[model samples]
Target: MENQKKVFIIYHSGYGHTKVQAEAVLSGANSVDGVDAELIDAKEAAGNLDRIDQADAIIFGSPTYMGTISAEFKSFMDASSSKWMEQSWKNKIAGGFTNSSSQSGDKTGTLQALSVFAAQHGMIWVGLDLPPGNNSSQGSEENLNRMGASLGAMAQSLADQGPEITPPDADQKTAHYYGARVAQAALRWAA
Candidate 1:
């Protein structure tokens, strides 16, 4: 019970594609030996701010639309006004993931926006430290952006047609990396 990692993932998926990536994150986090990762849909999260408050780290995910977090995720952030006022999310580790339609889709933009939001909330940010793009053999899909495009869990799903075309690999890797990174950060923070 002591020193177990506590991780929470809050996400919003419009067409259930992003949900695939979100679930992948949960899988990776749960695979970690000492981590407890939970997935909270934005709709469900709105009613249970405690879920966010109780974690050592929080990971946010969404389907990037118009180059940022979805309207649903924005609504969730807005609803967190109460927590923001109370500083409920402060001092915790934070991370993010997204799914869109292109290789350079608005997914990363969404992650950046979320990162800024976490900082504004007085939280620490954990980005993927894995080396993705440097290795030529790893290529695009095997690199962090290849097989694991998610050190921060930002993925792109093409079905939504945002330009992050054919992002299933990106989504899987993104989810995996985000989950592991969150768990790793939470464990350290909890220590």
Candidate 2:
């Protein structure tokens, strides 16, 4: 495993829903052979910036709050200014995911912010390759990528529900697929 590629998932979960999505992403990344994946909470990301710098891929996640990423996740982004100045993440593969209480919670805004952040660091942005699911007459809520997000994985949960019951299976699957895609891209990029 000495040559294994590392994938880091950095995220902030407001009500545990985003954390569930992050775990799904981790599971997907780890499913790839020779890939080692880990999750770092945004709250603790500042202390682990060096570890993230060494990763071949980095996936960001957060709960979409007020049409954007949570303030906590934004803080992590701000803390990485030093790395940005050094261009330490240049050429790294990057992806993003977000969750919110509404179906169309402007999750794209959060993903866009993440992609822009990666671009600022000179990292390559890996977007969801899945075609829009649940967009056809035959589509259903069980379809993956139901949110139809191409920028990144998107998940929606009910405000009244907890992470254990919300975000649904399809959204979880979409997050998983996106993670694997990023990991696979990282491997290819490194090669």
Candidate 3:
């Protein structure tokens, strides 16, 4: 539709685990009726910055490495300095997602970095609205928002497992829900 809002998911996945999460986020965003969602590999984003500029919302995804975003994704952030200088992304809806092998692999630090990156671009940050899950005595890894992240979606995968077998259904579902929320927010913000 002409009025459809665009959402770009820019991510860097080293071993495909984070790519799975990004795909889940894409699925959720595309599920919204008036949204057009697409994935942009962070490695290739520097050449497609204009496409990103046209987006109504942008969701960033990366694997948490050494307690923060991977160097490659950081490169994409640096490449956007031109946009930051021009405030081209100001007021655009923004959200983030990250994955790590350990459950508490300091993923919050990565989300904080993403948020800060968005802030530097003068973008509006959108956080996970779901209540913390798997925090109760009866809670299990099967709960959505299992990592209890509020800044963004978080997923954990076993170091030895592949994306097809790890990160679990709950994390994917949480990423999906987060994607939809961002899309909905974009629609409302544009309206």
Clashing residue pairs, backbone N/CA/C < 3 A, model 2 = none
lDDT of 3 by residue, 124-157 (tens): 9999999999999999989999899999999999
lDDT of 1 at 178: 64
- Residue lDDT tens for model 1, 80-140: 8889899988999998887777766756778888988898888999887765653476365
Q: At residue 62, give the lDDT of candidate 3.
A: 96
Question: In model 2, what lDDT does residue 155 have?
Answer: 91
When 1 and 3 are scored with TM-score, the better candidate is: 3
Model 2 residue 185 CA deviation (Å) reads 0.4
lDDT of 1 at 142: 45
Estimate, for each residue in 1-191, the C-alpha lDDT of model 2 and write its tens digit.
Answer: 97899999999997899999999999999999989999999979876788788899999999999999899999999999999999999999999999999989888999999999999999999989998989999999999999999999999999999999988999999999999999999999998
Cα displacement (Å) at residue 75, model 3: 0.3
lDDT of 2 at 121: 96
Ten residues in sequence with the least summed lDDT for candidate 1:
158-167
Better of 2 and 3 by lDDT: 3
List ranges where model 3 is wrong by over 4 Å.
Answer: none
Number of the candidate with higher lDDT, 1 or 2: 2
Ranking by TM-score: 3, 2, 1
